[model samples]
Target: MTTQQLHEQILLKKSFLCVGLDVDLTKIPEHLLETEDPIFEFNKVIIDATHDLAIAYKPNTAFYEAYGIKGWLSLQKTINYINEKYPDIFTIADAKRGDIGNTSSMYAKAFFEDLKFDSVTVAPYMGKDSVEPFLAFENKHTIMLALTSNEGAFDFQTLITNGTELYKQVLETSKTWKNSENLMYVVGATKAEYFTEIRKIVPDSFLLVPGVGAQGGSLSEVCKYGMNNKIGLLINSSRAIIYASKGTDFAEKAREEALKMQQEMEEIMSLKFKV
Candidate 1:
């Protein structure tokens, strides 16, 4: 989806919530284990339950990769289901993939062509060549890592180089690449205060924000600083929402949790943009 389409979805839903499908088989309802594809079954329930409340669904690739071919098939089924049923909802392959240009192109194809995700998360450690290939795909977004929410982000992202932080440098440098407009960023909500500075760099780019619900990052604070006129923030809540229950009412409980966040997002937009 184009950024405009994604922004439209955000407005239509009154939400920028991205429900993370970090499905762990061990953590899911035990009853699902008996199902043919437990992972896809769990995801289908969550997506069916909370589709209207959330603007996006992000499936962290690791969860599926760990299960080998079975896991990958589940991931495929999950994305295919979303595409067929709710094409308006944005899909993100939270793969964090980046390699040589050729390799990145194949990775891009796997997610964009095969999996049909609207976007894919990428690591910036390999520089422009690695990311430009993903950007080459029209209407597909390459969400590069900027100031991530993880504790170890301080090790490099915040370090000053040439009098500018590495993450800031990454943001500025990424703008010079081919099809840079397709770029979004992964900015952690835990570093909410930094959003002001981040906005000054990429004022219009979408930010895929994690660390909100489960990580204790404040929703209001992230919006106060990170929100653009388009409300460019996809606050993700994985474990807290998806694993809200280990019983048969799991989908209902997930909807309840997502509703709480969606309502909060609606209120935030109402006050900020008067939408």
Candidate 2:
């Protein structure tokens, strides 16, 4: 999806919520295991239940990769289901992949072509060459890591080099890459205060923010400094929503959780943009 399309969805839904489909077999309802593909079944129900409450869905690739081939198949099926059933809903392969040039290109093709995700998260440690390949795909976004919500982010992302922080350097340097307009970013909601500085560097780029509910990051704090004129923020809530209840009513509970966030987002937009 193009940036305009994403903005339109946020406006139409009155939400920029991205539901993280970080499914784990052990945490899912026990009854789902009896089905042919428990992962896909679990995902299908969650998608059906909460698709309207969310504008995007991000399936972290690690969850699928852990189960090997069957997991990968489930991932494919999940993306296919979303594309076929809700084409307007933005999909993200939260793979956090970055490698050498040729390897990165193949990863790009795998997620962008084979799986057909509208966006994929990427680590920027390897620098521009590792990221440009993913940005090459038209209308497909490369969401580069910047100021993550994790405690370990302080280890490298904040290190100053020649008077500029490492994460800021990554944000500024990435703008010089090929097809940089297609670039978005991953800014953890835990570092909500940093959004003020981050926006100064990439004022218009979209940010895929995690670390909300389960991580205790406040949505109001994030939007206070992170929101832009177009409302460029995709705040994700994974465990808190998807695992709201591991019982048979898991999907319903997930919808309830998502609805709470969506309602909050609608109110935020109504006040911020007066829409």
Per residue, candidate 1 scores C-alpha lDDT tens digits across 175-249 of 999999999999998999999999999999999999997788999999999999989889999999999999999
- Per-model CA lDDT versus the true structure: 0.96, 0.95
Displacement of the residue 93 alpha carbon in candidate 2, Å: 0.5
- Residue 155 Cα positional deviation in candidate 2, in Å, after optimal superposition: 0.6
The list of candidate 1 runs beyond 4 A from truth reads none
State TM-scores per candidate. 0.99, 0.99
lDDT tens per residue, model 2, 1-275: 99999999999999999999998999999999999999999999999999998999999999999999999999999999999999999999999999999999999999999999999999998988999999999999999998898999999999999799999999999999999999999999999999999999999999999999989899999999999999999999999999999999999999999999999999999998889
- How well does candidate 1 score on lDDT at residue 111? 94
